[model samples]
Target: MEHFSQTLARAAERKGGEQNLFNLVSAPLPEQQLLAQTDDRCLAIMTKVVFQSGFSWRVIEQKWQGFEDAFWQFDPHKLVLLDDSHIERLMNDTRIVRNGQKIKTVPLNAQFVLDTANDHGSFARFIAQWPVDDITGLWLHLKQHGARLGGNSASFVLRRMGKDTFVLSRDVTAHLIAQGVIDKPVTSKTALKQVQHAFNTWQQQVALPMTQLSQIIGLSVGSNERQV
Candidate 1:
């Protein structure tokens, strides 16, 4: 298992392409990265993004201080203490989204976080149950629980706190295709299966072509480790 983990880490050092460092989809603005975060700071990030999603990130970025002040830094225990009077005050605060429902959802979501922490003792203990640790899973979970998504125009936010590295965007996949690292474009839901097959083929075919590929060559890309 250590070998497997080491091999996967080494294979991941190769970036998608030279231009990918600036690619829009893979390299998003602050909101996505901050919200997708999974550390102890995550509760505050998730709280801010829930309302921040209603407006463009540009707007949120400009007024984030107002939000910080408004929410008292998103302390879970303090937020749960908010009563009807607090809601009235928040509804008029221009610093936040000022939408009643989204405002209400904040304290409730914080309370949910508190409840989960109470039951599980910590957030890390909570996420360990599921095996699918993809970036999409994180963002989708947030969206399902009442956090907002930026409309189709601004940006596509996936969970990318960068703790894991396999959440390659559409552009990243295209670059891999150009490099022959992956097979042809897969536009359908079955794309994942095709990738799996192509990768297996890569593993079987790599060693026959060169002696240097025999568990050798520094940070090698066209080797068995690149297969999957």
Candidate 2:
């Protein structure tokens, strides 16, 4: 819950040989970290997670390369050009989770991202405000139109992709419980809010770019004047 409970912070404070489980988890998969990078990739990661919330992050991480590749490296220009056939093909692509509905929103969400970025200065600026009602509107429309999972958790992820306000990772959740933020191994609302608040503050204080495993793929995809 507390920002101090971040895996890196905990790893620094822990007085044991065995690595903290949270550290072991976060040290490798840096998907969330990418979302906190420059404004451009920040929104790209959010768009990806809009569908990734309900599924296993491992799957998300695994398919991330394919997602990046298929989406033209998350470039607005390339993504906005994706057609219905592309969406249909992705549904049959075994490399990624074949959620037909969620995959369908990728192009539309691209249009939305460009619209938001053009209107609000950057998609990053738009999402940081955390508009709950508007997300409900998006969810209602998505469900009616055929998206699989566009609920509160996914919406929260969309908001969080703009900032590292909350630790959605399970290891971080358990760490918080170990650190007294919760009595049980849980991620409570109060704790999440406090951590989010702290993250917002810290995010405002610095500009950190994420550099994780680029062995598979990179968010640095496309040649569309990326801001990050």
Residue by residue across 21-61, what tens digits does model 2's lDDT show?
22222222234453344444753565556656667877788
Residue 180 accuracy (lDDT) in model 2 = 59
How many clashes in candidate 1? 0
State the lDDT at 138 in candidate 1: 39
Number of backbone collisions per candidate: 0, 0
lDDT for residue 70 in candidate 2, whole number 0-100: 61
Compared to the true structure, candidate 2 yields what TM-score? 0.47
Question: Which pairs clash inside model 2?
Answer: none
Predictions in order: lDDT: 0.47, 0.47
Off by over 4 Å in 2: 1-40, 128-228
